[model samples]
Target: MNSNFSLPNQKSKAILERYASSMSTSNAVSFPMVISHGEGCWLTDVDGNKYLDMMAGIAVNTTGYAHPAVVKAVQEQAAKVQHLCFAVFASEPQVALAERLKKHVGQDYRVFFGNSGTEGIEAAMKLARYHTKRPYFIAFTGSFHGRSMGALSLTASVSKYRKGFGNLVPGVFHAPYPQPYKYPRTAEMVLEHLEFLFKHTTPPEEVAGIFVEPIQGEGGYIVPPAGFMQDLRSICDKHGILLVADEVQTGVGRTGQFLASEFDNVQPDIVVLAKGLASGYPISAVMFKEHISTWGAGAHGTTFGGNPVSSAAALATLDILENGAMENARVQGEYLLGRMRALQARVPQLGDVRGRGLMIGLEFVKDPVSKLEHPELRDRVQQLGLEHGLILLGAGSHAIRLAPPLVLTTEDAKYAADTLEKIILEAASH
Candidate 1:
C-alpha cells in the first residue's frame, strides 16, 4: 500500500478543477482519484499512486485495462476503417459479432446493436410493444433498467434517478423483487404479488414484457431465491408476456455463467447486454428470440452502435473469455466468496455476504440480529478503501460490490480480501 499517498494529489486536483469547470454537474463522481492508466486489475492515478481496482469501471472491463489482444484488434480495425454506419452499409466486424453473439446465446435470437445499455433497453421496449401490441409492462421495485424515458419508467432502484423526471412512459407497473436474505420465501411472495397485480391492476393480456435483472445489480446485488427466474419464465409463458433479462451488469461471464439466467436454466425472450461487451467501449446488444423479431429494417437503427473498432475489440474480448478469463472469474469468485464469508462470521456488522461468481456484494448492518442497514458504515468502508489503495464501490443501500476485472488472479483476490477486511474492521469500529 502507498502509505504516503492521499487522494486528489496536486496533479489530480488540477485536472479535477478543469473537469469541474468543463463537465456537467449531473455527472456523478464516486471517487476523487484522477486515473493515469490501468493494467490488469490495477490502476494508477496521476500522482503515481497505485490502487487495486475492484469495480472494473462499474463492471465494464472484462479483459481488464488495455489487454493486448483487445488493443491489437482495435488497432487493426481502426487501420482498416473506423466507422461506416452499419445502418447504411454492411460491415464484416458487425456481422461477425452478431453471429458470435447468436452462437454464444445458444439460441436463434436476432441481435440489435446500440450505444449503451439504456439504448438496448429502449430498443427492447419498442420491440416488445410492437410485437405484442400491448401497452403495459412489468418491472420490479429496486430495479434499474436505464435513464432514458422508456427505460427510466422501468428503473426503480433509486428514487433520485427518477425524481423530477415525471410523466415517465405510461403502462409500467412495478412488483417486489425477492431478496431471500431479508425475507424468506421471497420468490413465492413476489409471485403472489405479481398474481395480485394481474388480478387487481394490470391485465395479463395487456402486459407487453417483464423486465428483470437475472441478479439485481443496483438493487444491492441481491440474488433471488432458487427457481425465481424459472417461475418468472413460466409466468411469462402463461401470460404471453416477453421476459427480458437486463444483463447489463451480470452478463458476459460475470456470474460464472455466460448469462446469469443460465444458472436457473431459464431462457428469456429478450436479452440486453452491455457494460462489459467491448471491455469499456460503447456497445450494447438487444437480442430477441427469432419469433419475436417482428420489426422491419429502418424501424430502429444507430449510426455508431456497432462501430467496426468496437466490434473487433468485442471479438477479441470474446476470444479471451472463451479461452480462460471467464473460468478465472468463476474460480476466483468462489475463492473471494469463501474469504469474505469467513470474515463475515467474525464481524458483527457485516450483515450479509451474497453473490454469484465474481459479481458479489457485502452488505453492512448496524447489527446482525436486527439486520438494519448501515449506510454510513458502508460509505466509510468505500472512502477508507481509497486510502488503503483499494478501489471500491457501493451497490444498493448498504452493500459494497466486488466486480473486479475477469482477469483477476487468486493472489490479487487475496490482496483485495485482506485489504477489504482491514477497511471493514476499521469502518465497523467507527
Candidate 2:
C-alpha cells in the first residue's frame, strides 16, 4: 500500500455515485453527501457543508454526535477489553448498564439486551407468548416495529414491506391507532373500535400481547387521545394480555420524559427500546416486569447484543439524559412546535402539527381534501431545506417529521424551524 496516496474527490455526490455502483440498492435512498462528522445537533458533509440535523439520524442520536462523556467512556472500555461472550462470561459494563436501566425503568424489572429494535421486539414477543402460553398478538395499524421477520409481521407501514411475505407468523391482528388529528375520534370511540375487534375479529383471551407505540413514531407522530393508553392498559389487564410498548424511537428522552408513557401514567408489561439508548451505538433492550423475567432465558440470544463498548457508551448517554438533556428536549421541542404551528397559519399545505417533545411532525395536505397526500410538495420542501443548510424527513405518507437531537438548543430549534418555514414558503410560491 502506498503511504502517501490521496483520493481525487471527497464530495458527497461522488461518494454517492460510488455507493450506488457498489452497494445494494435495496438499502435506502442515499443522501447527496456522505456525512463526515456530527456534533450536538449539526452534521458536516464531506464537502465541508454543515447541516442543522432536524431528523437526528432518524431519532437515534439523543446526546448528539460525539458527546465528550460517551466518547471517553467508549475509548476507555475499548482499551481495556472489548469482546466477551455474554452468555459465558458477563462483563462489568453489561452489569452496570443493566442495573442503571433497571433503576430508571422500575425496581421490579429485568433487562434483555439485543443489537437493535427489531431484536428487542422479537425477544419481547417470544417472552409474552411463552409466559402467557398464548399464540396471538394484537398490534396497531400505522405502526412500524422493525424490518425483521417477527417484527415486520407486526408492522403495517405498507404492502411494499410485506408483499411476497404472506402467511406470516399468524395471529397478528391490527387495531386502528387512536390518531386524533386525523381520525378526530374521542377516547371512547377508540376503545369501542378495540372492543369491536376483540368481539368480532379475535378473542381477547387468545391474545398473548398488545403491542403499541407510546406516541406513534413512524405513524406520523400521532399522539393518542387523552386516556386512550390507560384504557388500553385496562383492557389488557382484564383480558390477561401483556402490554408491550414499542418505544424504540420515542424512548431515551425523545418524548420529554424518560419514556413517553410516563406522561400518560400508564405502564407496560414489556418495553422495547433502541435508537437513542446508546446515542448512535448499536444497542437495544427488552425491559420486562419481574413476573416474566426468567421466561425461557436460553431460548433467545445475540452475538453482539451487549458488547462492552456499546454498553459503556450507553451508560454515559443515560447519564447525560438524566442530568439535563431530557429537560432541554422538552423545552426546545415545545418552542419548535409553537413556531411550527405559527408557520402553519400561513401555509395552506400545512394540514396538521402534532407531536410531543422532539418527536414532531408537520403533515402536508391539499387545502380542501385533507386525506390526499402532497408528496411532490414534501419533496420540494426537503430539497429546498437542504439548500438552506437544514435537513428534514418525510414519514408515513404526507408528513414532514422533525426528530432533532435532545441536545439541540433553543436557538438551534428556532433556526431549523425558520429555515423550514422559508423552504415551505418557497415551495408554495413555486
Candidate 3:
C-alpha cells in the first residue's frame, strides 16, 4: 500500500462500533477512510490521506465534490432562505430550475420535484396509473428502480433486496433485459418474450407504463443493442402505454448525453432524473410529457420537494453540465474506454468493457476462453486498488463500474486505468 493510503484507524474503528450499536435501524457499508472533505475528484480522510473519487459518490457528484459553482449557489440560497416549501409558496430557485429544465427537455414537459430517485419513481408510478387508469406496469429483470415499496416492487435485480419483503406493491410484471454478453439475448428476443408475457400473463390494455433504464446501472452497466430503445418506444406507442425512462444514473451527462434515452432515436413520455442532477444535493425530478401530466391538485405532493437550497444547487449543476462538463464527459469518457479496451490485450481476464461516457463497466472473468465470472478476483482488485489511492466500485457480480465525475482529467483517468490494470494482474496471479 502507498504511504498516503489509509490503514485501519483505531479511532474510526471505535466510532464505527459505537455507530453500529447506537445508530439508526438502517445499515450502511463504508470503507475505513473516515473522509473529512472532498475537492474536485479527490477525498481527504481525517488522518489526511487522499484518494481519487472514481465512483463520484455512486455517480451523484456530477460536478465533482464541493464544486465552487454549486457551493456558491448553496451559500447564496442559504443566506437568503433555506426552507420555503414550494408547494405552499413559489420560490425563485425552484421556479428557475424548472424553467431551466424546460429548455433542455426539448419537448413540452412538466416537472415534479422530490428528494430522491425512488421518490421520482413513486411519483411516476402514481402519474402513470392516474393517467392511463390502468392496473399493471412492466419492468425488466435485473432492473433496480429503488428500494422504496413501489420501486422495490418494480426492482428485480438481486433476490436479497426482495427477500423478507414480500407482499410488495402489486401489478408489476418483469421481463428479461437484453444482456448481449451473458446468455446473448437479442433485443428482438427480449421484445418477443415481452409480447408473450403481454399475451399470456398481463394484457397490454391493463399496463399503465413500461419503465426502463437507458443503460442498466445496478444490472452491471449493460447497454442494450442498437434500436432496442426505439423498439421499446414503438411497443409502448402501439399499446398506449407510457414509456418511463429511469435516467437516475445515466442522466445529466453521465452517458455523454443529456439523457441516455436520447442516445436512442425516441423520446420517453416520462424521464426520471437524480444522482448527478444536483451535484450532491438531495433532489430528484420526475419529468413528464405535457399530455401525461393530467392529475389535478391533491394527487401527489412532497414537503421537501424543490427545496430552495437544493434547487439552487441543481441550477448550478445544470450550468456546469451544459457549459462544458457534458462535453468533457464525452472526451474523457472515450479516453477512459479506449484505454481500458487497450488493456484487455494483456489482461485477458477483462471479459467485456462497455458503457457510454463516464458510466463504464469493466467485467472480470476467470479466463478468456472460459469466460466465467471472477467476482472474487474483482473484489480483491477493488480493495487493493483502493489501498493504492485508486477508488473503484462494483456492478453486477463480475464488473467494476467507473462512474467518475465529468470533470475528470486525462491524468486522473490514466492513473486509475494504470492502477486498475496492475491490480487486476495482481489479483489474477493470486
Candidate 4:
C-alpha cells in the first residue's frame, strides 16, 4: 500500500480553499481529498491519488461510482426527455420504476417518488396522518429519519442536528431502541418501554405511526435483536398504527436482502427507500400498502420528484442488484464478519462488531469489560485510514461504519479487512 502520498496536494489544496470560502459551514467535510472521479470501489482525488472507498457516500452508491449500466440508462433517458413534472404529466420512466418497486416489495403497493430520503419520510408522515386521521406519531431514540421539520421531529440520533432548530413538529414521541450488544434483553426492555409510553404518554389510539430503522444507520450500524421488528409490527397492528420502516440506508440489497426487514420476516405498512436506490442519483420512494392510498390528488406532489433520468437510473440499479449484486453482498458480508471477529479476539479494545451485509460497524471501547466508549480512538482510526489510502466514516459515538458499495469484490474486501486491522492496531497502541 502506498502511504507516502501527501493529502491535500497543491491541486486539492486550491479547491479546498475555494470550497471553504464558497460552501456553507454546516456541511460536514471529513477529509481534505477533493475527489475528481470514481470507478468501482475506488476514488481518485484531483491530485491523482486513489483511495479505497468503504462508505459509498454514506451507502448511496449501491453499484459504485460511474457504473456503465447506470451511466447508459441516465444518458439514454436524458437524451429522450430529461424532466417532466410528475405532478402534472405521467412519465414512462417514473411509471416503470414504480412498477419495479412493487415487484421487489412483493406486495400490492402504491409508490410516491421524491428527490431524497427526507422527502420520502415527509411523505410517509403525511400519508400516515391522513389515512388514520391521528395526530400523534412514535419514533425511537437514536433514530435518524431526516432533517426537515416533520422528519426532524422523528429523528433523535444527534443533538447537534436538533440544536438551534427549536420547536419542531408536534405530536412525535420517542421510545428507546434495542441495542443488544450494550445491554442484554434490550428487545424486551424496549418493548416494555413502548407499552409504558402507550399507557402513560402517547395514546395508542391517537398515534398515527411508528417509525423505525431495521438497522440503525447514522446512530450506529446497530442491528436490533431477533424479534424486535416482529414485536413492533404486532404493536402497530393491535393499535391500528401504521408501521413505517425507514430503509434509507439499509435498502436496495445493502443488507444482503432487498429490505433489511426481510431478515425478520416482517413487512412494514410503509417503506421508505433512497440513498442507494439510484446509484447516487438523487431520488427516493415512499411505498405504502395499497389500502392506505386514501389521499386525493393534489394532497401531496412535487415538481422535480420523479425526474425521468433519475427513474431510469433507478431502474438500471434495480436490475443489477437483482441479478447478482445482492448475493455478493451476503457472501462478502459473512466473510468480513468472520475476519473482523477473528481480529477482535486479539484486539481487546474492539468492544463489538455488528452489522448485516456491507452495512457494518466496529465499536471502540476503553476496555472490553466496562465498554466505555472511546470516541478519540475511533476518530484517530478514521483519520489514519485516510493516510493509508482508505476512506472510512464514523457512526454513533465511537464506531466506524462500513457501508461500502455493493459491488465490492472479494479481493477488495480482503484488502479492506487487512488494512483496517493494521490501522486499528496502530490506533490502539496510541
TM-score of each: 0.97, 0.95, 0.97, 0.98
By TM-score, the better pick of 3 and 4 is 4
| 2 versus 3: better lDDT goes to | 3
User: Is candidate 3 or 4 superior in lDDT?
Assistant: 4
Residues 129-200 of candidate 3: C-alpha lDDT, one tens digit per residue: 999999999999989899999999999889889999999999999999999877688999999998999999
Could you give candidate 2's per-residue lDDT for residues 1-430 as a string of tens digits?
1111122336866767777788775666625667899887889889888889989889998888888999999999999998897877799999999899888788788888999999999999999998999989988889999878889899987778888887778889887887776667777886888899888988999899999998888778888877777898999999999999999998989989888888778889999999999988999989999997666647888888898999999999999988999998899889988998998889878878888999998887777355467777877887787777888877887788899889998889889887887889888777
Q: What local lDDT score does residue 346 receive in model 3, on the 0 to 100 scale?
A: 76
lDDT of 2 at 312: 94
TM-score for candidate 2, please give it: 0.95
lDDT of 2 at 386: 77
Ten contiguous residues minimizing lDDT sum, candidate 1:
1-10
Q: Which sections of candidate 3 miss by over 4 Å? A: 1-6
Q: Which portions of model 4 show Cα errors greater than 4 Å?
A: 1-8
Overall local distance difference test of candidate 2: 0.85
- Candidate 3, pairs of clashing residues: none
lDDT: the better of candidates 1 and 3: 1
